[model samples]
Target: MGNTDKFEMIANIYDTSERIQIAKASSDAIREYLVEANSKNAIDFGCGTGLVGMNLLNDFNSMLFLDTSQNMINQIKQKISDFNIQNADTLCFDFEKEGLSDLRADYIFMAQVLLHISDVELVLSKLFDVLNEGGHLLIVDFDKNEKVVSDIVHNGFNQAKLTDIMTKIGYRNIQSKTFYNGSKIFMGHDASMFILDSQK
Candidate 1:
């Protein structure tokens, strides 16, 4: 499926997805990055159904919930079911399309969504452009996506390559860590995170 289709599809079920629930370690990661976020302003790129956004509602001052799928954004609205979303706004966008100017944010977040991009260079470059001075970005997903999912998904920016691309974009404090047992067995949904801090 294309990026737009991801959320339209995920939006239907992401509230329960293992990735977005803010696990203990995952929540710790988010808190650490966001504490340095400096501003409550945030942008959630490819925020399918806002599942990740829901976890972060308390973290941001105002949120520009962005996705390529209008249907997905609509699904987010449907999924959230009327929380006090006054501080929330939605935008239809594709990272490769390069129109990231609706609003700038101190923080940019992508969760369970980064690997679905084919053009990390363009997207990260644009993200760097849109970031406020001393901003940060937190991206969370599997270092290894499922084979079936990968076959149909467009997840090209794997961890090592992604770290390289973000560094090329001048994003600082780049770190990547993988989480899994020594067995290397798939536990259905495992935890892995890449946290990037924008020094621009």
Candidate 2:
């Protein structure tokens, strides 16, 4: 099954897994790097079950939870209602297919999302297009690990290589740092995760 389909099937149990702890760590890192003035509007691209975005609702004036799985979006919507989160909303969008030309945000975040995408450059280009000038793009994903294998997902990313891609895509002030190390997080293998902070 495709990653979207898999996520759709698992949406009910996704938030209950150990992955939610990782999302919490990612959200904490994002909070640390976020510029106070640039936190007006944010988009949590590939936001699954709103784990990370839900933790950051108070940081942004408005939050858009975008994902490909309808089930995932539904979970986020349910959370919004349950918490009475007025400034948060959800969108079921597959940027890989529909594109992001109509969207704009002051900050865009992707946690454990890029590795699943088949065309990283295409997604990065579209993210650049959607972000307002000087907006920030915060990405948290695993560092390169050959031990983690997957047919549907990229093994992970190299910080230097990712920085080069972001620079070529018109992002500035590119900076990345490995922030977490978890056992059996990726394909049952231990892996480290890095957070990339860049500006448009």
Candidate 3:
């Protein structure tokens, strides 16, 4: 099955898995660099089951959880009703097929989403276009690791190269830092994850 189908199959169990714990850690790391006051509207791209974005509900006035899997979006919608999250909503959108040309946000948060993308540069450019001026783009993904091999997902990313790409796409004040290291995380190998923060 494709990645979206795979995610759809896992949608029900996602929040109870170890991946959710890792996502919580990723969200905690994002909190350190996030300026809560500056984020009025945020988009959680590739938000599967809303693990990270749900925890960040207090930070933004409104949040849009976008994902390719309808099953995933269903889980997020359930959570929204369960928690009475009036400011949170969800959309099943595949950025690779349908672009975010009309949609905009004050902050765009992508956690562990970049590696699954086939065209990173194109998506980054689209994200830049969607962000308002002075808006922030927070990306959380695994660092470059040759130990992990995958035909579907990327092997991860090089910080310098990713920064360069963001810069070329008109993103400024770029900063990246390796925040989390987990054993047997990526493809059953030890991997380190980094957070890249930039402005549009």
Which candidate wins on TM-score? 2
Q: Per-residue lDDT tens digits of candidate 3, residues 1-200?
A: 13898898989988766787888888897777777634489999999888889878788889999999999999998988988888988989988886766899988999989998998988888889999999999999999999888899999999999999999999999999999999998989999999999998
Please give the ranking of all candidate structures by lDDT, highest first, separated by commas: 2, 3, 1
**lDDT value for model 1:** 0.65
Cα lDDT tens digits for candidate 1, 43-106: 8777777766766777777888888888878876664556656677888877786574756888
Structural RMSD, model 3: 1.6
* Candidates 1 and 3, the one with greater lDDT: 3
Which pairs, if any, clash in model 2? Answer: none
Clashing pairs in 3: none
Minimum summed lDDT over a 10-residue window in model 3 is located at 30-39
TM-score of each: 0.77, 0.97, 0.96
Residue pairs with colliding backbones in model 1 are 40-61, 115-155
Ranking by TM-score: 2, 3, 1
- C-alpha local distance difference test of each model: 0.65, 0.90, 0.88
Worst 10 residues of 1 by lDDT: 180-189
Write the number of the candidate with greater TM-score, choosing between 2 and 3: 2
